[model samples]
Target: MLAVLEKVSFLLKMKVAQGFQTQIAGFYIYLGLMPSWSTRGL
Candidate 1:
């Protein structure tokens, strides 16, 4: 039971990390694709 709980927590952490990475990557991609637009908006 403890092991299963640990595994679930670990998977959740991994998913959160993956989500953060993807969001950061998407932000970079957006900047790369439209630097001027981003700059202007910012």
Candidate 2:
């Protein structure tokens, strides 16, 4: 029973980490796009 609980918690942590990484990647992509957008505006 305890082992199962531990596994579940580990899975939850992994999911959270994955979500956090995806957000970070998206943020970086947005940052990468911003410079081109600004230059085009000028």
TM-score of each: 0.77, 0.82
- Model 2 lDDT per residue over 1-42, tens place: 999999999999999999999999998898787888785775
TM-score of 2: 0.82
Judged by TM-score, which candidate is best? 2
Candidate 1, run of 10 with poorest lDDT: 30-39
Q: Could you tell me which residue pairs clash in candidate 1?
A: none
Q: Where is model 2 more than 4 Å wrong at Cα?
A: 36-42
Off by over 4 Å in 1: 36-42
